[model samples]
Target: MSTLEIKDLYASVETKEGRKQILKGANLTVRSGETHAIMGPNGSGKSTLAYTLAGHPKYFVDSGEALLDGEDLLKMTADERAKAGLFLAMQYPVEVPGVSMTNFLRTAKTEIDGKAPAIRTWTKELQDAMTNLRMDKKFASRSVNEGFSGGEKKRAEVLQLELLKPKFAVMDETDSGLDVDALRIVSDGVNRAKENTGLGIMLITHYTRILKYIKPDIVHVFAGGQFVKTGGPELADELEENGYDEYLPEGSKESALA
Candidate 1:
């Protein structure tokens, strides 16, 4: 089975004040078919871990190792990482004004697969995925995310996840800004991916509402830039009831916000 493993990962970003460390020796492992929920308050470095794994240029990895089925993910460029079966569904998807959704999705699939999908099959697959996400067929002609609503943008993200069929996905607060119906639609798509492909998931979020829709196999409490606790799905219910108060030290609640 495939595995994405992180060991003592420490990363930083350059700001006006110079380099600021975010992830501090965080570690985790996700095997295919497992969903790991990363729950924390704001600024606790959940996004940092996701971006770092996907090889985002903004973050600098000072130390640690991330391996995807025995391959070094840190050594690969962002596109290379995608080719290696890693996917990141960003919280805020960017708008590509000139790129049609159809072209973008096909191009991405072709690049990652090292081959162009047959026109008929690919077209049918694309339409099927969009329909499953409740997206309009006309969206295929529109420029990516341009003039799209928040729910539409997130649905597009899941569409990519479904069509591309990545080995593992890092969903960074994908539930944010989604209405109840949109949330269920997106969560259903995620569940379908996991069931169909045995796709491993690193789901980053703050609330447990999404947990009800997409049950996690494991729950991790992220705080102070690292995972302070790990447990089964019950941990999520506990967090929902108690919040992060018991995990955060006195006067350190701010650290949980990430």
Candidate 2:
């Protein structure tokens, strides 16, 4: 079984004000086929952990380790991390102006697998995955996420997740900007991926609505950079009834970008 292990992680980012720390001693262990929900207030280090794990250059890992299976992930570059079966679904998916989704997905799969997939099989598989996500067939010819709506961009992210079949996925606020229907569709896609591939997921979100659709095996409450509490799905219900207020202090609700 595959496992993603985070150990005493400390990360920081550069700002106009200078360096500011985000993740501090955050640790969690996720094995394949498990869904872990990370819930916290705005300034908690959830997204930072997601980007840090994906080897984003802006987030510097000051100390500690993130391991995939048994390999060190922090030492790998972004592409290297992808090839090692680590995937990140950003809260805001970026637009690739020139590249069509077809070319990009094919190339990515080729790069990760070290060879191109069979054309006939890949084409059918892509069509099926898109259909399952309720995406238009014409989307294949368009540039990746170009001119797409918020929900569309998010569905595109899940489309990649379904096709790429990564060992571990860090989904950062995937529920953001999604409506009720879109949220359910995206959540279903994620659940399907987890069931089909035994993919371990780190679902980061500020609200618990997404949790209703994609039930979490473990719920972690993040505060002041690291997790302050960890529990079962019941924890999410508690947060939903109350709020992050009881868990976080008054001035601790700053934006996570700090």
Candidate 3:
């Protein structure tokens, strides 16, 4: 099985004031077919960890090694990371106004695989994936995530996850803004990807509701820019009942509760 290891990761982002450190010596390991849930309060740097691993330009790695099967992910470019079997489902998926979903998916698939798929087979696979995600056929011809509803955008992200078949996926709050039915559908799509490909996952979120569907094998409490607690599924139930107050600092507790 493949392994993604994050070793003493330190990262930061620039703001008007200055560079603000986010991830401070964060470390974790995820094996193929295992799901790790990262739960934290807002501004706790959970999303920062997700974007940093995906190699987003806005975040800079200060000192760390994100090794995917012994290869350093911090050394690769963003697209290079993807080619190396890493995927990020953004918290807010961006809009690509002129690109058709059909063309985008095929082009991305071709790039990742290093060869274009046969048209007939690729077309069938795309249709089947979309259908399984409960997406409309018309979405294939529409601009990628342009003018789509929140749920539709999320479904489109899962569509890419299913089609691209990444080794590990950092899903950043994918359960956010989803209704009950949509949540179940999206969760099912994720489950299917894991089952089909043994895809490892780092699922970042604030609530345990998504955990009910995704079922994380490990749950981590992120605070003070790093993981403070790690446990099994029972930890999520505990967080749900008690909230992050115990995990937060004195100054941060009120805001977290509010």
Candidate 4:
């Protein structure tokens, strides 16, 4: 099985004041077919870790190695990282106003696979995936995520995840803007991808709702830019009731509660 390993990762972001550190020696490993949930309070560096691994330009890795099957992900470009079998489902998926969803998905698939998918087979696959997600046929012709509702945008993200078939996915708050029915649809898509391809997942979120559907094998409490506690699914139940207060420092606990 493939493995994605994050070793002592430290990362930062640029702000008006200056470059501020966000990830201070974070580490985790996700193997194929395993789901790891990263739960944390706001500004605890959860998203920073996600973006850092995805090779987002805004976050810089200070000293660390994000190795995907022994290859250093920190050295690859964002697209390169994707080609290497990593995917990021952003909390806020951006719109591509002029790119048709059909074209974008096929083009990305070609690039990642180093060959074009047969037109007839690809078309059928695309149609089936969208149908499974309960997306309307018109979305295929629409510009990627443009004019779509929040739930639609999230479904579109999952559409890419299913089509692209990445080895590992860092899903950043995928359940954010979804209602119960929409949440189930999106969660089912994630579960399908995992079952079909043995896709590893690093699911980052603040609540336990999605965990009920996605069912993480391990739960990690991220605080102070590093993992402070690790447990099974029961940990999520505990966090849901207690919140991050117990996990935060004496000073940060007050702000987290507020």
Name the regions of candidate 2 deviating beyond 4 angstroms: 253-258
Q: Which is the winner by TM-score between candidate 1 and candidate 4?
A: 4
What number of backbone clashes does candidate 2 have, counting pairs of residues 3 or more apart or in separate chains? Answer: 0
Q: Which stretches of model 4 miss by more than 4 angstroms?
A: 256-258
**Candidate closer to the true structure by lDDT (higher is better), 1 or 3:** 3
| Ten contiguous residues minimizing lDDT sum, candidate 3 | 249-258
Which has the better lDDT: candidate 1, or candidate 2?
Answer: 1
Model 1 bad stretches (over 4 Å): 254-258
Colliding pairs, model 4: none
- Rank by lDDT (best first): 3, 4, 1, 2
Clashing pairs in model 1, backbone N/Cα/C closer than 3 A: 41-257, 41-258, 42-257, 42-258, 43-257, 43-258, 44-258
Q: For every model shown, what is its TM-score relative to the native structure?
A: 0.97, 0.96, 0.98, 0.98
Instruction: Name the runs in model 3 displaced over 4 angstroms.
Output: 254-258
Ten-residue stretch with the least lDDT total in model 2: 249-258
What is candidate 2's local distance difference test score? 0.93
lDDT of 4 by residue, 180-253 (tens): 99999999999999999999999999999999899999999999999999999999999998888776778886
Question: How does residue 181 of candidate 2 score in lDDT?
Answer: 97
Query: Per-residue CA lDDT of candidate 3, range 1-258, in tens?
Result: 999999999999999999999999998999999999999888899999999999999999999899999999999999999999999999999999999999999999999999999999999999999999989999999999999999999999999999999999999999999999999999999999999999999999999999989999999999988999999999999999988888788877676558
Better of 2 and 4 by TM-score: 4
The per-candidate count of clashes, in order, stands at 7, 0, 0, 0
